[model samples]
Target chain A: MSIQIIKQGMADSIQDNGRYGYQHLGINPNGVMDPIAATAANLLVGNDLNDAVLEMHFPASVILFKQQSLIAICGADLLAMINDVFVPVNTPIIIEKNCVLHFKKPLSGARTYLAVKGGFDLQPWLGSYSTNTKAVAGGFEGRNLKKHDEIRFRAAVQKYDAVLNGKDCEILQWKASVKNFYAAGNILRITTGSEYDWLNEDAKKLLLSSSFTISNQSDRMGYRMKGDNLAIENKQQLISTAVTKGTLQLLPDGQFIILMADHQTTGGYPKIAHVISADIPTLAQLNAGEKIQFNIIGQQEAEGILFDQQQQLQQLQNACSFPLLKFKQQYAIN
Target chain B: MKSPLPYHILPLGDHALTIELGNSIDASVNQNCIAVFHQLKQAGLAFVKDIIPAYASVTVVYDVTAIRKEKPSAYLFMKEKLEILLAGMDLDQPVSHRKIEIPVCYDLSLGIDLQEMSQEKNMSIEEIIQMHTNKSYRVFMIGFLPGFAYMGSVDEKIITARRIQPRTNVAAGSVGIAGEQTGIYPLDSPGGWNIIGQTPLKLFDAKRENPVLLEAGDMVSFTAIDINEFHIIKGSI
Candidate 1:
């Protein structure tokens, strides 16, 4: 029920819900920025919400355990393989002990998450298992996994006779499709910033309607974007304060600064619009030069969408037919 | 455009509001930002999660779902609320702010830009030190890096621009000047600020409950200290 690193691939690291409560201390909350994909894979394997998983940047390779276990891969259409054969994403696959699981470089996007049945058991620091490479704290020695790193799992697994006995290879019905939630290069929804009045009506219209490209100067800290020039009522210095993920910092150079998962705690740029919280995951998948437009939606609508997303996740949890796992033990609550 | 002080009240995800304090750069507006920002911090709204104040504006992170349940028109409601907040902003008001006294050593060893700045300002090393420590500066805002406090207007005589080439790492608590602004480096990081002196007081501590000691609208004063006091404070921390 465990795996070890033989070849660490590119940039594989340990990630969970990210380290919170430390942002005030100048630490970035580094974690799996794509919650939907990570959580979906976790739920499929019956793991806790905050369980640590292996986050592979682009692609990676691993050696399987001595015991058989369930595993799921989610996010990014990175060409993946189990041993030498191609493996599909979003479905639970059982791998025999001592098998090699390898993933190829991203055919399209970056970041692929791999979750195991019993979850990866690594000690957390400051209440989180997420890694911050810049701060050199938490997760895999405050760094990414390297070759010859021995990884281990904590809990013993009580095997569930794979449900859907009628099903054969790749139980597509048992999983939910998160790919449907996104449309490549679509307009991201935005809400007006406090500085909108500073911009003329034409500039506001441009901000709402024009297309913006993610600039080359980007990283986990922020996405420097090139788009319509937003005119401020006046130009001057900005004092610093707490800026979080999804924060849009309008720089003096007339470019938009969209804060990301690993952004600094504070900023001086005037934010013109905030990338809606629900849309942040969408932003996470974006690469440099990918163009996107803004679609303004009401705050209530945004919240309703978030609430609905959470509700859907809860629904998946409740509808899980655990009792049906073993017909003989079906009626037993324990 | 009018007395209402036109600006935008934008949304930041489910828990933030980006509030533009004024249309442009004005010292009066910056002071207003400090004032209203302090008031809102005291008011404490449930929808609001965090408020970020910048040079000429402020951003308020809030949960919009909590703010509006009825699905009201965002354009009308947000604009109206923004106007009311700005209209009510009164300058002749008082609010409590935190005060921090920093101990500095302006010795030549740690300050890389000292000699050049001294020559430019046409003053001796001691004259520059006295001029910098003479005034109590306000923390206008915090940005760039963690614990980095952007402060202002130190006698104009010693005012200087950023270094032509940024240093790879500026020691923590190092006090510097960049283009008429004085600030303290909260963490050791690569910076372009003109190095003038170094402070022993910790600007940021991850182990502490409140990581950053300084906030917007707070007052800071530099008090020169001997190496003995510097060593004591360092050991105590």
Candidate 2:
């Protein structure tokens, strides 16, 4: 009936697409870091894209399932296992009652997502299930998942009669291809920002030519970068303005930070660039000390990539629902 | 009717676009930004998710999937729509401005930095309170925290810089001034502003029908209140 967290993770919380339309009131949209992965995980489990999912970081929480259920993990490959047996990512898996789910070690990527079949049974705050830890609203007591916290699933998954074997977990046949979304290399595509002209010619050149290391001070708020000191022509007291996720703001001390999912609604720093919306999933998977380079692409190209990604997600959602409907009709006709 | 101000549309990202009217925080520039905000919201564009108005800019967040169905590019479609909306529009038209009177208690107990600001500005606490309550301010932006409305143009004589070291936790309803701008702390947060007063009224109530008390482009004026009145009003809410 419920999944109890036996071991605590660094920062595991329930998240969905995001809480939107509240940025004007200074309320940020705190959602999943990797939308591609989160959406893929939800689609694999035949849940709505906006259904609540557990976003877990490395050293993720250990959970004990008290009922048979369907789930899928995506994003970072944290070496997930069920009862000490390895389970693949981006594939729907059926877990038997009283099974334990845990992660082995930090393999690749910074965060991962786990989606349940019918989603979590909880009241949403301000029209979203995404947890806003700063505002202390929405999702599992408005905080990170810790030890001994029990989260109830909306409905128990009907026992899969096709695979009625003595096994702790049953991995399905079909899997989703999420590799194209996370492109090769650390080169992130970006477009010029409002204050891109503030940087001198050499500083502008340095931005594209050099690779910056993601500093250890980075967090969900933003990723501070360390690289060549890019100097501006002058320091002007700019008026504070609306900023969004993926904004690359230049600090006064010459470093820059890529604002992430939990960034402030407004900022005063000069915005030098913004990572393309399509590539935010790739950027979200990067960990501290990882070196990343920026490449400025045209705005049209950025929009094209984002549009294509949405289309691909829709196609995946359509493809996954067919088999899920057939399986439900055959076994659970209630 | 006066023509609209010259502005440039810049892409914040693939999903959003920012309209920069000017560089400074002039009233006209801010008004123009607010005008665009109202017009876009009234248009009822299904693709548009949200619109934010700052000092001299307005950002429109849109869904690329929906935009792609209608037009090839979201930026190009939105920019053209905005350009057309601004062209036929008259900037001289009066915008909807709600003048709200806020009750603030300037007692030294709640006004943590009143004594320090009084000495630094070479004025008495009473004079400081009078100067703060005398003039009205415009809500240029609501940011930094939920319901945190950034009001501007504090009395020149009482203009003070932020604290050298910011306090880790400034209580909610604390009114503070930093440079030429003054704002209320809707939530207890780390801030460097010089606190001069506290309002018993909740700046933000998530359970309330309207979560935020103030919005961008509203007119705000403060009235001095005694501690007894502050407690009375605080208890009623």
Candidate 3:
């Protein structure tokens, strides 16, 4: 069974958990910018959270279903319409064959993810299907989806019974999309980076006190901003060194680069601070001109919070295992 | 040499620590990085993920949750281990030399910035090539690009600054000089280095078990080759 693309979005590509362990080779592990939402959508459809899915940017839609299918629309609210009926986010819906699935546009966030049972059948590239627009590798032909690109599907043990049973229209129970839980604008706490000491006292204060808006310059690689131009006390060339995802780099030109999912393996810029790992998902959802404040935090406190967040993910994994764990339990009961 | 004041093993992120051996950047700091690297790995610090040796500073990645559970002062644990390791290490470690023949074609058509680099260095194009190839260099680090080794301590005479304008794309294995340091591009990437020659060998290949030809702290020397020899090596690879 397969789904065909009718209306290609502004930018759409397949992405999974991302490729790792190759940073020493200078390769940036590019993947879904909003991993949390992507995983949520996959879980709703009872698919592996790391399974490949179509990541669509603002403004797009597609047609799906060969022998009926179950899918979930996630990430941005995006005013998604299912067969002329506007549907809510964070829920599973059974789609019929030849249904004209339309995602009118993203109103709140930048990108959205669509997950199907058994996952989209996109062949992996270099062990990942993530789209790295800069390196021009990975994803579909290592680029964005074009007009009328035909996407297929993989067969699996559990074809959503709701779809296989040939239900005309069925929507799953509702749970609020995670976005609804957060305050519109909250202070982002970050651990002071090694370069924090290098920043002039005035610049350091500005970093703490000032509000910065996510500029249109934001992309998968880095997020640019217009704010109180943070400065460094010492303006010497820093020899290139290894950096990682979430490294908040301050450029010599008095700008900040919030490293994202597709950030380079290493960098020479003096890193100002790192956005706490738990907040990275929220940071990814931010769209152009979304204003947010930065608050300095202690490393120990942040690590404690991060551990709690990890434990929560482990719980999520345990919870999602109903897709397979259900069968094991039934067999034991029999 | 005087023992380091003491390194503050502070957490960097969820999985890393910035062990500050000295506040100032110096050769001693780099040596300390090398020393800590040896000690941490020798101790079979499985929780210690990776160590990135920087200019005067080294950041070691580890599971913060694990470290916190252990409640070991990163300073006490690391410093204690380093003191023992440094005490045993000899400053005059035997340095091995390898004559790695890189087939480089010094043609301007392929090198792109050959003429512009020579003009900046205030030397004949031929003179620049000779000075660059004649010097043996120490591999300081492997970064910037895969298999791209940062070899340095070049002869001061040909120490030209990096181009103010970075080229959008420098082909893989391009030999370029940035200031006193020379490096090879293992992958096609944008760079600010002044390109003087192009190497024909494949510096990186994912298929190989050890994809990189050079690593940090290795010794390297490049030998010039004719365009015909370059094509032969290039095609054979």
Across residues A209-326, which tens digit of lDDT does each residue of candidate 2 receive?
9999999998888999999998999688788888888999999998999999989998999988999988899999999999999899998898898888899889888998888777
Worst 10 residues of 1 chain A by lDDT: A163-172
Residue A137's lDDT in candidate 2: 75
- Badly placed stretches (over 4 Å) of model 3 are A3-7, A60-67, A98-100, A120-142, A147-169, A174-177, A180-184, A316-334, B1-8, B20-57, B63-99, B206-211
Q: Tens-digit lDDT track for model 3 on A285-315?
A: 7888888788777776677766665555556
Q: TM-score of the A chain in candidate 2?
A: 0.97
Candidate 3 colliding pairs: none
Give the per-residue Cα lDDT of candidate 2 at B105.
99
Chain B TM-score, one value per candidate, order as shown: 0.85, 0.97, 0.82
**Candidate of highest lDDT:** 2
| lDDT tens digits by residue: candidate 1, A1-334 | 4687888667678889777544433455678877777777787666786788777765475655555566788877687776676777777666656667777667755567888877777777777888766555567776888887766776685443343242222333355567645544667877665455666677778887889899989776788889878777756555554567777788776778888877876765776777776677777777788888888776667666665666666676555434124432652312
What fraction of the true interface contacts does model 2 reproduce? 0.77
Docking category for candidate 2?
medium
lDDT of 1 by residue, B1-237 (tens): 235555566554556555666654345667777776766666664455455676666766544544445445333354466567677766655566688788887877766678998898889988888988898887777666655777776887887878888999888878899877898887778889988878777887655666677876778888987667777877898
Clashes of each: 27, 0, 0
